[model samples]
Target chain A: MATEQKDETVGTGTLGKTMAVLEAVALAERPMRFTDILAVSGQPRGTLHRQLTHLVQEGLLELRADHVYLPGLRLLKLASASWARNEFRAVAAPFLEALHAQTGETVHLGVLRGREIIYLDKVESRQAVRMNSQIGNASPVYCTGVGKAALSTLDDAALEVILSGIEFRRFTPQTLVDRAALLGELEAVRRSGVAFDREEHEPGIRCVAAPVCDAARSLVAGISVTGPAYRVEQEKLEAWVPLVRQAAGGIKNELDARLGPQR
Target chain B: MATEQKDETVGTGTLGKTMAVLEAVALAERPMRFTDILAVSGQPRGTLHRQLTHLVQEGLLELRADHVYLPGLRLLKLASASWARNEFRAVAAPFLEALHAQTGETVHLGVLRGREIIYLDKVESRQAVRMNSQIGNASPVYCTGVGKAALSTLDDAALEVILSGIEFRRFTPQTLVDRAALLGELEAVRRSGVAFDREEHEPGIRCVAAPVCDAARSLVAGISVTGPAYRVEQEKLEAWVPLVRQAAGGIKNELDARLGPQR
Candidate 1:
């Protein structure tokens, strides 16, 4: 048992606070101590300890002989099992690798998280101008290629909710800040079965994206190919659209097969 | 909140019962109701609900709108993060694929789990004589190539503890059950840095494995290539020893760099 003082206040309910501590641990670059978690999560000592104890007993956290904590094997087992069953990753990894090999461009996989898009995976090209993205990195959902691909799957009500919560920030000259403009783009994405990020997230970079939907017709995730503006021109991107869409379709098909018709 | 009927006869602790419920859900292969968990875990309603509430709060489990329970995104996030950080997968995947491409044999990455060896990752070859060793599968630590590679890392006392716990059930003719004999073989493994399985766990399958050690010289994991016994004879396995060792070394170097010299 370990003890530490906590000064910062957290208001996201007891369960939410517990989740915050776990998230803090998960996001850490290394194993952490009780004090480190307290500092990062800003939760009171008593609350954090109680939650951690429960987590330890549940095997979600491992308490080493040195009293430092790390994510436990149980969490790893659960995660691996889930990932093994994930249709999206199974379908997309080979395709993404193929896309990278074919065009010498970086590939990305992402899913919506609140008003942001969380990157699930990325395959970097062996070229000099590599696209900068990392697993677990998050960016605004209204600008990135993967973001529009996912947004195109949602109904108007769900789309409205996401748009309402976001404080649209401009990253470059091409970023869409207005709700109407973004909605129009999403509509176009729905019609085209593809999405585009023409330097919307980062200047001098462009990406083409497509949606992966489960058998339930619900959007699960998105796949994108990104490269320099000079290499990935309008004509070149248009030519690759079918490939991207085919990859997404293949993933959806796999997901449906594995998950038994999704919903 | 999910609930279970308590068993007065069994003295399993609250945490243990909670783990049992989660394990039951995992083993069932689909979302389960409160009644289902109660039946499987054999815990009282009050205790089960409290445990489920805690687990759900921690994001280890999720309750559907219809009240069925399933593993949650938190599990996926933790697993993916750990897997991404795991050096064995990063280093071994390419080499394993290369081995498969060269020899048309199944390749495996395994680590010691208690007294067993669990496959962390695997790449199957296109050959018709395929083995059933899939990722997440487990085998006794004394019988398989990867198992012996991992077991060779333990000190005498730790080895004795593991040996003492084993039922020593023989799987095949080559399986080692005698403690003294196993110890001598492990000594050879430590000196030579390789382990072999001549159909010890499965008939008609032969494997050659090499130890992957971190910077601190502790065994992190093992990598093995398996093929039909007729195709992978003593002389051929001897030839493969260098390739397996080199792959293990490559993975160890990457692991050391990524995991910060390993504890």
Candidate 2:
């Protein structure tokens, strides 16, 4: 099956094209039509149709009666299996619970997924008007507490690569759309070991976040404490900063104890 | 590009074979060798190799430096994206938190995947000696409270089909190994609207479970309250049954309110 082309070349084989199609579908936040996929993936219509049909037949993609496609449960099973084996979620679960209990605010665990932050776990507060961040939700890196917390651990070069081609959309009035302002915030996050989201992603929501690291001291994910603007005042959020950082440290210690030696 | 074969008969195509390889890797629960896949899938070596190479090159399957294969992050991203859109996890998260708060026990949201129950979400209690059940962990259907809760919703024929081929190995002394005994237990579960684990899957641990159903009155998943045997005594578990059922019902209502009308 080896072609004469170099291995690193994109779209050099059927596998590469198949992967591009899957990526396009995965990145789509909703079920998409064939034309929409072609626009996103830039694949030829003939090739895209053939690959999509193959994917649908293989159970990797499911086509609705409306002729739109979405990812199937088979993929969900695989991801769930892998996340189960990873020790980070187990270590962070208790901390997430404690954060939820202490502040009576929603807590989230997020990790870097390309230029975005994908929430791995979340604990909702018992309050009447709470934020709605379900597990597996994703948000942009520049405006979210968890995203900034995780991104703060990256070196300048790595950060540049992530920031490089992304269209920085203004989510809210408080969103730091300017690259220099975001970079400044990241610097503060790196020094203080905390990040803040003051109605950046969603209006009237405030959050404080801290990064969790693996045995190698690599920033693997982040944990956050989030609440409504009226409930979580500036002083209140500042007071919870240490608590979030402590929980993140506890998670890091547990991961190191369990998986550090193995890695 | 249409072949003479019908779409259904195109199961022998390269894409079909590639998907089979990915599914086989997921089921194996560990990195697998080329021969292990061939043995499980019953595909000819040439066809298997071609598809495996395609998958590995495409980043759906990662090839270790030593040549073993495991599911990649690309597959994980796809699954997580699908999970983000799922309404079940959202509706169950709050109830899981309430159960954890009331019982000081680990609470789980699991759905039946074939003959196993795959945990979609968990709220771990903040206790020194807590029961260990991670999100995404799969447990056998006959011995787990969540499994029984879910299985109780199935009709007799569907239940029989699921129970027909399983080799029930006893994990603990209380586990039901005989098919007739398991069926008897399931009948009890159906009558009571609750399922009991009775230390069946692990020593000194017990759980009480209830089913979450869609508006169509079909079971979509189950929720469970698990803790140490001493804390969750039979009397205490009996006391918690109503609360568990209420939480399950509330979650079902939310699911129906969100997704039922659409389906």
Candidate 3:
């Protein structure tokens, strides 16, 4: 059935408005009341009410008896499907496991998303005090090892665009505080084929990371071995560089074989 | 700014159509081509094209250069937000860990969604060989330990509604083959305050499960300790019932404290 066409200029059609409602609910840290969503969406009372009803019916959002909205289980099902079918993450999974086994540290597979990195997969360490980075959480591209490793593979112009957009919010004392400092570090990372987070993002966490590329040599993602700063000191991080690079190359080769030269 | 209202009768407004498109992509095990989605959606080419374009723009779907559509990273972001804020799952995590520690087995926390149980949280056993149940995967209520445990908690009328809908696809000889057989088992489960899966869902895998309830004593979810049947024999499964029941009760108490009687 051909649904009625919506005004192109107004909220980018029905699909756009629907996504806006979903995002409004998803982005909030807590359950949002109907009025709270109304304040954020600025939609008409009846229209917003209808949209909320539709969203709840579709399982994209759940409306509680208290009249608050939260992201629903359907999102998890969809995300699971997304995660399972993602070729890069699937190809990198065993490599992540192997790297984790070798280093006995938490392994992360993160993809560059604009000026941030979104973790796609994680193989957590068995250690009780390991760094707790949740999958799907976004971290600033300027500070994270995975972020900088991905940045190292980008062309100068693409890197410049990303750099220009980044606000160097100092996360820790060791975080690179200026564009010049980060660029200099990127130069080093490019030469070494690895990136290091020296308690740069979190106070007690550090990591060694390397970028994974496809057959076309385009950066697809980055893999990192992260741990508590005290355990993964500078010497240990340096020692694990070869292992990290090997895992990244292994993922790249598997991705290349699976994707067969991205068109 | 007020947007134009969509036809209420057609496609449940724009949100419904959008979710349809998303579900079409998500339900597919592989990346879907434009034609594949079009075929599945039965929407006009122009309408489907616009929905796909809008979905990609909103980061809810990614259209690869190869012209295949996949569920997007935005789904993961939304799912993660949903997962983090989920009160029942959050309250059950530490208890799941404790349960896993006590039994040295894989622990799963799953919630009843319709007639299926969707795993919300999982703590994998350290053993190299264990039952691989991914979080977010659904299992039939008639064949799985968690499913039967949840069914044990429901009143007869509610249980009948669910039981009537279930098609007893026998996964194994052990699976409950009909509603009468399942009801008989559920009667035993209710008396015991635990349920068992004796390789009913998947051969060589078994679990002992108990239903977690809210402050109102309403069934909220189920917690299970699953392992390979060869290792977790019937004797062990029988022995773990008390531990599983305790974990379930702990989760119920915590959830009660967190949500305060669920309004």
Candidate 4:
């Protein structure tokens, strides 16, 4: 399967179109009318109509009595199957729990999903803070602690590709908007084996994060312990450097045990 | 789009098969090697190989260095989008939170997905008890409180389709192993506008549940108040009936506000 011809496609040729319509619906953020879908899609009316009908039959989308559409539960169920089999999540959860328990702050485990850091898991502290992140939320790779930590391990060529498309929307005063400045920060993060976000993303929130790598020394994911700026000051943030790194190492070792010795 | 030709497919005409392969991989529960996938898929070697390669290229699957395959992050991203746009989860969470707070017990919000009930959200009590259900986890619809509540709202024909495939793996003596018995239970639930699980699914755990319907008077999801047998006894379970129904009504009203009036 790995070496199979890349362009050979099978079954109904409309799969890509079907999926595109689904993605459009997912992005729409509301139950969509047929006319609304027609506006989003490039497909001709007859073609789009057929695709929607088959999709409804396949349980990928639901049709309301008023003829609006929402995502069907089958998508959720399939996603759960993906989550259940993801080894990084299973391997890092206990260590994440321990780190959260030790610090009594929000802990996050994230993996690089293309140019963005996709949050795989999160443990919200009993004392909650106002944060936009949840388990599946995505954040830019140059700002947040976990994102920077994971980004630090990427080679120059890989980093260049990611840097090309980044929209450096100035999130806050502390956010790094320059690529050179970000690369410099990554260099420091690579040296120290940890990264810090001093309210770079959200005001009054800070975190220290470290990259989690496999036995091959390839970066896989990142973890962070985060708290409010008032509570987790510069000193407290620095203090988490060793703890976050240790937790990262602990996760790496567990991965190594399951995946064999380091290359 | 709904009235387009039933079988008119575009692109590669192989979308359904590709999705089926993806589903098989999802159900495999482990990173699967080529031969492993071959065993699961009915497609010949050439066809299956092409499908896998294309899927990997599409970012629906990831091929590991070990030559095994796992779900790629794109699936997770799409699922997150589905979850984000799901008004049901958003409308039901606060009510679930209040229910947990009021009853000091575990709260679950699930939706009917085919024959199974998919748990979309859960609010764990501060004083937690051992429980098998979690967010994204699923349970059978025949015996569980939330499951039965949602099932009772389905029309007889649709109900028959779901009931036809149910495997009565009795978890307890109270589990409904026969169709007639389950139908009788559903009839009672319809009359009372609620459902109860007297440790039918899991011994020492019981719950009272009610369906949440949309403004169109169609079943949307179900909510339940669950607790240990020692604390939430038969009498206590009965006491929760009104509370669950009230919360269910709250969710319905909130949904109605967003979705407009009954058709």
Please provide, for model 4 over B1-263, each residue's C-alpha lDDT reduced to its tens digit, 9 standing for 90 to 100. Answer: 13232222234346666777887787576678898887767678999998898777666788888788888776777777777777778778789888877888888999887778888877773512211126566689988899999988888888898899787889998898899999999999999999999889998889999998664445557999988898888898888888999999999888878767544
Over 4 Å off, model 3: A1-12, A127-133, A215-219, A261-263, B1-11, B127-133, B215-219, B261-263
Tell me the TM-score that candidate 2 gets on chain A alone. 0.85
Model 4, span A1-263: residue lDDT tens = 13232222234345555777877786586779999898767667998988888777666788877798888777777777787777888888888888987888888988887778888877765512211126667788888999899888877887888899787877889999999899899999999999999888988889999998764544467999989988988898788788899999999888888877433
Q: Write the per-residue lDDT of candidate 3 for residues A67-129, one digit (tens) a residue.
A: 778888888878877776777776788898899889998889898877878888888646232
TM-score for chain A in each prediction: 0.71, 0.85, 0.86, 0.84
- The alpha-carbon deviation from the true structure for residue A193 of candidate 1, after best TM-score superposition, in angstroms, is 3.0
lDDT of 4: 0.79
Number of the candidate with higher lDDT, 1 or 2: 2
Q: Score the docking of each candidate (DockQ).
A: 0.23, 0.25, 0.44, 0.36
List, residue by residue over A1-263, the lDDT tens digit for candidate 2. 33233323275366676766776686676778888887766667887888888877665676764577877555667666655544456678898888877888888888886777767667764422222225556578899999899888887788898888466898899999988899999999999999999999999999999988664433357999988999889899999998998999988888767654644
Interface CA RMSD, all predictions: 6.9, 5.2, 3.7, 4.8
Candidate 3: residue B223 Cα off by (Å): 1.0
| Tens digit per residue, CA lDDT, model 1, A1-263 | 34453522244235455556766676577879999887776657886787788777665666754577776556556554544544356567777777766666788888775676767667763412211215446578899999999989988788888899778889999999889999899889999999999999899999999987664544357999998998779888888898889878877776667667434
How accurate locally, in lDDT, is each candidate? Answer: 0.71, 0.76, 0.81, 0.79
| Model 2 CAPRI rating | acceptable
Give one digit per residue, the lDDT tens place, for model 2 in B1-263. 22232223246366665666676786576668988887776777998887787776665766654477766555656676766665467677788888877877778888886788877777773433222225556688999999999888888887888899677999998999999999999899999999999999999999999987664433357999988998768999999999999999888777768664655
Q: Estimate the lDDT of model 2.
A: 0.76
The weakest ten consecutive residues by lDDT in model 4 chain A span: A1-10
Candidate 3: the clashing residue pairs are none
Q: In candidate 3, residue B258 scores what lDDT?
A: 65
